[model samples]
Target: MATDNKTSAILHRDTRFVPKKVVGGKGSYLFLEDGTKFLDSTGGAAVSCLGHGNEQVNQMIKDQMDQVSYCHSAFFGTQVAEDLAQLLVDSTGGKLSKLFVVSSGSEAVEAALKLARQYFLELPTPQSQRTKFIARLPSYHGTTLGALGLGGHVQRREPFEPLLSRNTSHVSPCYAYRGKRDGESDADYVVRLAAELEAEFQRLGPETVCAFVAEPVVGAALGCVPAVPGYFRAMKDVCEKHGALFILDEIMSGMGRCGTLHAWEQEDVIPDIQTIGKGLGGGYAPVSGILIGDSIVQTMDKGTGVFRHGQTYQGHPVSCAAALAVQKTIQEQSLLDNVREMGAYLESQLKQRFENHPHVGDIRGKGLFWGLEFVKDKATKEPFDSEVRLSSLIQGKGLEPEYSVSLYGCSGTVDGIKGDHLVLAPPFVVSKTEIDLLVDTLEKVLKDVFASL
Candidate 1:
């Protein structure tokens, strides 16, 4: 067991905190070497949908290792990889017909961007001028340069701004809590957002744009904010009018995180290119991929007949086997049903607890994913000062021995540098008892933190 006093070789996110070493985990709880158990509410940034120490997934990984763990996709494709890809394709009802597997969410977004650009280039008309992409403000795509440029999270991109690409632009996100006007109806708000997108396309010259990228439900950067009704269809219409592909970044909200198997399913509009990760492998392995629509697939088939981008571990046998097992388990256990039922319960409990809290500006989300936004004045929806670090305090207090609950906290929700919010995404296997405990512990943590302030 690693002692707390020992100097760590791994460079953690914050050197000051140096998080506790987790020794083991099962279901919705993680255990420390000292026997302290933490109820995992955020699932390590919403990745472990099936929870920890899943015997079935573990056995599958081991079994795959015994046969063959590593194989080059170019040299040979494993049956597991093909099976997983086919399953993902079928899950989309043939909407997204092809899969380009990768090792992380960033890689998936990178692949999507490259594929979009290549699609335009490969077309018979050859739109060589279409080199620009339009994303949304307060959205997070990933950390890599191309993906980072495609995102509009101001804080995360500030330090690397010089190195980021200039081909991408951003528009206001469909955040009803703030973006919606005082008396505006949902349809009006959507129309306004669509107008902004259309204006952006015109500003950039429609023929020069390759794609419009967005998240079906904004994650950390905006605290689980879902678009208003008809928001997606409106944006898709604008993209269609401008002849640009519509790409949905489901890296954090897809794969049953938001009730449905795909977040876009709830929106009633399909994306031309979709990227999925995090929950794909349920934290059993690092896996992500780009799902290509029929048009893009056909374009590539008729042109170069190959995607230019490739990763060394693009289709590792073990990762694919683990992902296949994870997906199969979700389907076999009918976890989506549980997610919906439990998610409704969780949402009700959260509203009942924080509805009147002075610091809680909003509580919003769908399925098992939820976010609690903090503010100084609920009436004005004024966020707390950045220095207050309210979300971090709540996160730290929740992890203390007294609470022993884990929550995901993020900053810059308001404008990429000022807002604070906490996310709760328990595993699909989470029970009602666990949900109650999670809320109770969080209530105590909130009371304790606020009392000190």
Candidate 2:
């Protein structure tokens, strides 16, 4: 696969192969170097919310570059950063008091973890023993060491186990499709999950726990699985009971990607600290941020008057300008309204197409973010062996000439090594026609892959 000079030039995610080169992109399609255009159904891991070749965002980057691009956070601050931060804070109705901008989701999460610990330390009654975190199994936060420690994806953390922080522990996620017992009511399931969290806190000596971190809508590791109704509120109650912060990792599910600007908004719960990324900069620039709530901010303000952490490029001017433009465009264009409308259309189309498929065990998600979990037997919900790489096959088939669609596929949805699922997160600008094409292409790809299997 790397026989060609271009393919061998750089080390890709898998050294065994290099993907086709995409020369350009426009709207919802990416043009390969060979002239084939593939529909970007997954938005490149749900990052490109505004789609490609956005003229306004590109112009914004250039304009910012002409003025100032890089400014060290410790030495100076930029208006672009302040404006973006203010907009983010305002969007949350001041519930989130401050924004700590960073380059990626992992960095944002790392900052959040550190901030949580610092918040406890800054309290009038210091919680010096509060050093541990409780995260959900089959969840993904980020790749950085600190963020990875807070995640619960077994396979991902396996290789780095020796190096991971022992301060973190895992709990079962609120995965109704798998976790809920037969004939169990949603309320009962919520109670069960909440009890499990409370048990974990007690087991860890509740006073030693700093936070309970999770993605409101589980991403890559669990394939866009949303919490059961009232699940987050219950989980937050447990956290509050233990005096631990509730941190929501909204990297792949926020910034209007999940109908609402923040995924937690739909859950009747607000996190004390939130990390947002992916769609924040709309793939126009590398940008992510932590939304610090009033309690944390006020504690810092009254205690040290400064956060102990700082990054050299904490708020790169160009990145801030690009994100500002992307966010403003989302608001001025009222893209959330489109997201809701198109999301409903997409959901209905997917159910109509795959609800009865033998291999499709479950179809779940919210807004434009949706996932299809495949299984060997739909009734039994038995997943194909991980060695089969069913999700990867489906993803590869989408990029073929006949299908021409890009899908996000991941393994280990069940227990971090046994389940297969594909995620589809089209851009907010997706039209009904495009949504139909996406579903049709996905259906064809699934059929083709299953036929071969």
Candidate 3:
């Protein structure tokens, strides 16, 4: 995978190691400059939903560029952006009235936070005291300061702690693998989590909280863990009781990636603010946004009629157009049904391959988003030493000629420093043969790595 780093001007995530070079991609695979091909199993942090070189998405972007590439959203309105927002609202049956588009998932969270605070301020009674936010620990909202502050991944947030806002606090997430103690039923765990959330609000003075933020299906921080039954409902109940808006960050797990248009659709609760990205634009452009429920949208309409926040690229025409085309493609092609069928097939194949494997701790996810948490001892669920870098090893090996695969890998799944996980979020347009190739390659990769270990 070595390309070159000495002369590079880009400051990549790792300067110590140079990565492979790619010349082009089409469908479910990427072609290296030298023509070495690799299946894109994780889609570069799960962003490329429609897959590489999607003609419809590309055509839409090009057409949008031909029309108007960069119209400052502040002074003008773009029909493409408006149409995108309308599509999103209609997808939710208009339960959510508005969406504020941003350039990335981080920006969406930032906007949601600001809007939530403003929602309280615009209320008739004006609860300006509602300034705090509660998010789950071992969770990731985004990488920007406010989003990072709100995200509870300890190691990622530690270096920037002094610069982050102090108003956001954390509570335990609904990670059944580690969070559920012996003999704790799913119903019991939900109650316990709800109580903990209530306690956090009480300790912080419930009146001071503006929103409760969390992911419906936990991403990297917990390795594709979905909350237990009734979990979201319980958390939302706590938030409602505290007069705090409920916010769901579905950046990595929404937009038909989870076999549904919205991950919250399966949860049976509507979020007051829902942040979506990654799959939103299908890697056609830098994009993300927050869909606001009527409770907050109408409140602002009756009051300021303006959300006191704006980004230079907010509601960028090209990005919105890309997203709209991506969504339309998904709908027109019936990709959600494929996600369900393929998801079940992928799930079955995964369990059949790794369920009995000693090193695979858990296989968790829904639809196309799945993850394998590596453990040293499955019985005790003890994680490998962080120094082993097992997840990255699996990822690196997966990309080698022998395997020819790409996956999203991360460590510190347990307490931000003690666990390892490999994510498998293939493009929504993947086919059965591609799924077979992915699983077969993964099995060989896992077996090969475990042998050396």
Candidate 4:
């Protein structure tokens, strides 16, 4: 298994990168082939909430493999999937009781989009009345054709514009830091965002709108931006008034990442269809799924008598087992408290390190998921020129000698192309010492980069 170095066949993230092959991981560190250890601060795009190589989760996977490796959802339903669904439903207090299993976050999001479409089809309205979806600019749902269409990330969609569906419409995201007008109060900002959504539905003909898609806490696209108070409540009202379903994509922001089991819980609103991943399986396995409310399930239950769309690996046994164990660990061990505690510590450390730094314009996020927004001018909140690629620069600098932190890079936070942000979503099990060290390492790297500039 070792010798054939015949030009790697896999498509690396960066073609120029001969990335040091990772040999193994333990705790929060990833070990490379050269025996170098790097702290995985971003958890590979925030997926590994439980950190690497947890014995409990590993053991659970082994037990499941020994008992039963795979069970096709079409002809059979495994106890693992059933139990996992039950646990998730109980977590939601039965609000979202039905489940649709998928292997990835993108798949989960695709299911949500289809489910939302189906939800509207089940409505008494005409087929043409339920064909449009509303999403926010600078947002990301997933990468599949359907989910990508639902997303508003300009750069990601630019190449696929001709192929994407034309039924989707865009609205301004609730990004108070960048979208809120000057002199606008929090309430006013929320109202303005809601009005924009309402207007979008109107422009698209409210009757033709199937659902409104959004992230409860904007992840990746806007760098963990949360909405202003009452924002979701207002948006939910608008959707309901228009006879449209509210679909929340919490694939990156939910499942205890935002100090609660669900990000929507903090918004004082619940979606008709919810998409969750990342923290769901804590990266112990490839697990992501849709949580369906009673209304949507009842519609399908009474109309088609079966969910029309499904996957071959839906409710995968091993995936379900790993997820169930991860969920149980999060609950039984009381990890939410750690998320809050460590999150606060991380926030304080970040503020102490970058609050007054000239280029560090914004330090925002909740729980352990945080972001650092770089700027050329802090007063006007002007972003660093896109050519500078501050996020990428910091990422590279972080991995240099004497600094082994891995930072998540993102672009287009401002007006879809100008801003740069580095997101840090460390494992929920991160310690205060680790938080301190991470912040210190980040501050040093920032200083070095700024000084060079």
The estimated TM-scores of all candidates read 0.98, 0.98, 0.98, 0.97
Off by over 4 Å in 2: 1-7
Candidate 2, 253-299: lDDT as tens digits: 99999899999899978899999989999999999999989988989
Per-model lDDT: 0.92, 0.91, 0.91, 0.86
Clashing pairs in 3: none
Output the better candidate (3/4) by lDDT.
3
For model 1, name the residue pairs that clash: none
Q: Which of candidates 1 and 4 reaches a greater lDDT?
A: 1
Which residue runs of candidate 1 sit more than 4 Å off their true CA positions? 1-6
TM-score of 3: 0.98
- lDDT string for model 3 (98-153, tens) is 98999999999999999999999899999999889999888899999999999999
Instruction: Tell me the deviation in Å of residue 403 in model 3.
Output: 1.6
As a TM-score, model 2 comes out at: 0.98
Sequence-dependent TM-score of model 4: 0.97
